[model samples]
Target: MKFKITHVTTYLFDSEVFLEPHYLRFRPCQTSYVDVSDFITTIHPQPVGHKIVQDEDNNVVEFCWFEGMTTQLTIRAESVLQTKSYNPFNFLIYPQSFNTLPFQYNDLQKKLLFSALEQLPISKGLIDYALSILKRSNFNTISYLTNLIKHLHDDFSVEYRAEGAPFMPEETFQLKRGSCRDLSWMLIGILRQQGIAARFASGYYYFDMIAPAYELHAWVDVYLPGTGWFDLDPSHGIFTGNTHFPLASSAHYQHTMPVSGGIRGSANSKLNTQLIIKKL
Candidate 1:
C-alpha cells in the first residue's frame, strides 16, 4: 500500500525563551519492506543551525539549534511511501549472528527477559488465565504471538497522553495498558533483559480505521541472529512491515524524541499535534 503522511507538532509558551536546541528523528529510509518516494520537513521561524548525522545504533538523526527569544515552535514532516505485508512468525529465527557485536548479556537483561516470558501464557507468569484457553491444545509461537497482539489490541486503549511517564516495564505489564510508546518501552526492556539487543523506534503510521492521519508512533525491534532487527508492535498486535517507516531509533524513547528543547521562562505551555494520511 502507498500513503501520504503529514505530521504537525506545535508548542506554545506564555513567555519568550532565550534559546532552544532540538533533536529530530523524523525521516525514514527506504528499506527492504518500504520505500520513501518523497519527503520534506518545515520548521517555523527557521533555525540557526542544523545537521543530519547517524548515531551509534545507525539511526538517522537531525540536530538543530534555535537562538534568541521565542514563545512558540512548530515542526512539520511529510512523506509518501509503500508498505508490505507483515508476518511475525517469519522472523522467529535470526538470520545472522548478532553475538559478535559489542553487546553483552547482563543481569538486568536476563531479569527482564525472564519476566516477559513468565507473563506470557506459555511461561510461568499468568498460566492459570492462559490455561483456560491453552486447554484447546492449539498453540505455537506464531499463534501465541498473534493472540498476544490481538489481546493487547482488545484489552488496551491508545491515548496521546504525555511523555513524562517514567520507563517502567513492570507497571505496564500490571496495567496491561499504555500508548504505543509505553508498550514499545516495555518490549524493549524485555528484549534487552533477554540478552537481545532491542531499540525504540519512533515514526508515523497510516491506519485505515483510525482517522486517515499520520501521528507520532512508537514500536520495538529485536535483534535476530542473521536477519538483524525485526520490528514488533504490541499496540497493533503484529509485526510491522513495509508500511512502517522509522524516523529515529535508540535504546529508549528519551534518546529518539522527534523534537526536544528547553524554554527559558516559566510560562505555562500547551502542545497540539495533528496528523493526516491518505493512500496514494
Candidate 2:
C-alpha cells in the first residue's frame, strides 16, 4: 500500500520572540517493510541554516536555525511512502532461557541491553497486576506478552487528552485509564521491572481501508536474543507490523518527540497540530 502523510504544527506566541535552533524527528524512514519517498518539511519565518543528521538511535533528525523575531511559527512536514504487509508473528525463535519469567540473560546480552533492563521503582500493586494475567507455573514468553497486551486492552479505558504530559506509570497503573503514551510508558516500566528489555516507540499507524485518523502514536519493542526486537502495541492490542511505521524508538518517551526547541520570550504560546494520512 502507498500513502501520503501531512503533519503541521503551529505555535502562536503572545509576543514576538527569537527562535532558537530546533530539531525535528518527524521524517519517515525506509525500512525493510517500508519505503519512504518525496519527503519535505517547510518552516515559516524561514530558517537561516539547516542540516539533516541521524541521531544516536538512528532516527533522521532535521536541525533548523532561525534568524529573526516572530510572533508565530509553523512547521509542515509531508511524505509519501509504501508499506508491505507482513505477519506480525514472524519473529525468530527466542533464546530458550528467555522463554520464561525470572529469566536470566547471557553476559554479552546483559551488557548490551543494560539501559533497557534498568530497574525503575514500581509499586507492589503493579507487580501483582502484571502477575494476575500470567500463568506463572506454565510460563511462555509469547503467551505472557500477548496476555499482558490483551489485559491492558480489555481492562483499561482509553482516555484522549488534547494536551498535558503523560501520566506517570504508577499513576496510570493506579487509575487504569490513560492516553496512548501513558499506556506505552506503563508497559515499558512494567516490562523493565520484570527484567525484560523494552523501549518506547513513536510513529504512525494506519489500517487498510480505514478512515484517515491523523495523530502521532506510541508503542513498544521488546528485545529478545533471537527475535532481536519485537514490536507490540498495547493500545490496539496487536503486534506491530506493516501498519506501524516507526520514526523513533528510545528508552524514554521524551526522546521520541517530533519537535524539540525553544524560544526566547516572556510570552506564553498556544500550540496547534494537524495531521492527514491517506492511501494512494
Candidate 3:
C-alpha cells in the first residue's frame, strides 16, 4: 500500500511575540517494511537558523530558531510513502521458559530495558485488570499481551483531546476513556507492572474509512526477548503492521510530541491543525 500525508499546524497569537527555538519530529524513520519516497517541509516566518539532527532514539528532528517577532507560526510537511505487508507473528520466542507470565529477562536484556521497564506505583485495580486478562490467556506471554490490547479497546471509550499530556495509567483506567496517547500510556503502565518493557510510539495509521481526514496516532511498543520490539495498538485492538507508520518514539510521551517549543511573551494564542491522508 502507498500513502500521501500532509500535516499543517498553525498558532495565531493576539500580538507579535518573539519565537524561541522549536523542535519538530515529523520525519518517519524508514524500516524494512516501510519506505519514504519523498518528504518536504515548509515553515512560515523562516527561521534565522535551522538544522536537522538525530536524537538518541534515532528520530530525525528539525531544530529552528527565529530572529524577528511574528503573530502567527505555521509548519507544514508532506510525505509520500510505500509500505509492504508485515507479519506481526512471524517470529519465535527464544528460551521456552520466557514464554509465560512471571518470567525474568536475562542480565543484558534487563540492562537495555531499564527505562522501558520502570514504572510508578500501580494501584490494585490496574493489577486486577491485567490479571483478569491473564486468567483468560492462561498466563501465556504472547497471548496475554495480545489479549490486553483487545480488552482495552472493548472496555474503553476512545476520544480525542487535541492537546495535553496523557492521563496517568490509574486515571485512564478508572475513567474508562481517553485519547490515543492516554491509551498508549495506560498500556505502558500495565506492561511495566507485568515485567515487560514498553514505550510510547507516535505515528500515522492508515484507515480507509478516515481517509482525507485524520489525526496523529499513538500506540505502544513492547520488547520481547526473541520477537524484539513489537507494536500493539490498543486503540485499534490489534497488533500494528503495514498500516502503521511510526514517526518517533520514546519511553516518555513528551519526547514523542510532533512539535514542541516555548513562547517569549504572554500573548493569547489559538491553534489550528489540518491533516489529510490519501491513497494513491
Candidate 4:
C-alpha cells in the first residue's frame, strides 16, 4: 500500500517570545518493513539556525533555533511511501528467556505495567502470565504470538488523545480502554519484565481517519531471536507489517516524544498548539 502523509504542528503564545530552541524527531526512517520514498519539512517564521543529526539510537534528530520576536510557530512534515502487510497473529515469541534480561523500571511505566497485570487478576507477574498463556497452546511461536496479539485487541477498546495527556495504566485497565501509546507502553514494560526486548516506537499512521485529521502515534516492536523485530499495535488490534512507518524509538516515553523544548518567557504565559495531519 502507498500513502501520503502531511503533519503540521503549531505553537502559539500569549506574549512575544524572543527565541525558541526545539528538538524534532519527526522524520520517518527507511527500515525492513517500510520505505521512505519522499519526504520534506518546512518551518514558518523561518528558523535562523538548524542542524540535523542521528541520535545514539539511530533516530533522526533535528535541532532548530529561531531569532526575533515571534508569538506563533509551525512545523510541517509531509511524505509519500509504500507499505507491506502482515498477519497480526503470526509473530515470534521467545518464552524460555523470560527471566534473564535486566529490567530497569520507569516510575510511570512500572506503575502501569504492574497495574495492567493486576487487572488481569492472574495473581502472577507479567512473565508468569505470558508463560501460562503459552503453556496452554500447542502452536508454534508464530501462532502463540498471534493469539496474544489478538487477545489484547479483543479485550481492550481504542482511545485516542493528544500528547501530554495524563493517564495511568491501571485506569485504562479499569476502563478496559486505552490509546496506542498507553497500550504499547504497558505491553512493552510487561514484556521487558518477562525478559523480552521490546521497544516503544513513535510515528504516524496513514489511513482514512474518522476524525478528518492525522496525529502523532505510538506502537511497540518486540525482538525475536531468529526473526528480529515485529511490530504490534494493541490499540488498533493490528500487527504492523510493512505499512507502519517508524520515526524514532526508545526504552521509554520521554525519549520517544516528537518534540521537546522550552520558551524563556513562557513561565507566566500560556502555550497553545495546533496539529494537522492529512494524506496527500
lDDT of 1 by residue, 86-129 (tens): 65456434322332332343465445434222321122343343
Residue pairs in clash, model 3: none
Give the top-scoring candidate (lDDT).
Answer: 3
- Cand. 4 TM to true fold: 0.77
Predictions in order: lDDT: 0.65, 0.85, 0.90, 0.65
Candidate 3: Cα lDDT at 167: 93
lDDT of 3 by residue, 245-267 (tens): 89998888888999889889989
Instruction: Tell me how candidate 1 scores on lDDT.
Output: 0.65
| Local error of candidate 2 at residue 137 (angstroms) | 8.2
lDDT of 4: 0.65
Q: For model 3, give the 10-residue run with minimal summed lDDT.
A: 205-214
Runs off by more than 4 Å, candidate 4: 84-132, 138-140, 165-168, 208-212, 267-280
Tens-place lDDT per residue, model 2, 1-280, is: 8988899999999999999899898898688788897899999988999999887677889999999899999999998998887877776666677777869888988988887787767789988888776664367788889989888888888777767666878999889899888888888888898889998898888775455556788899898878888788988888888878888887766778888899898989999999888889
Error of 2 at 14 (Å): 1.1
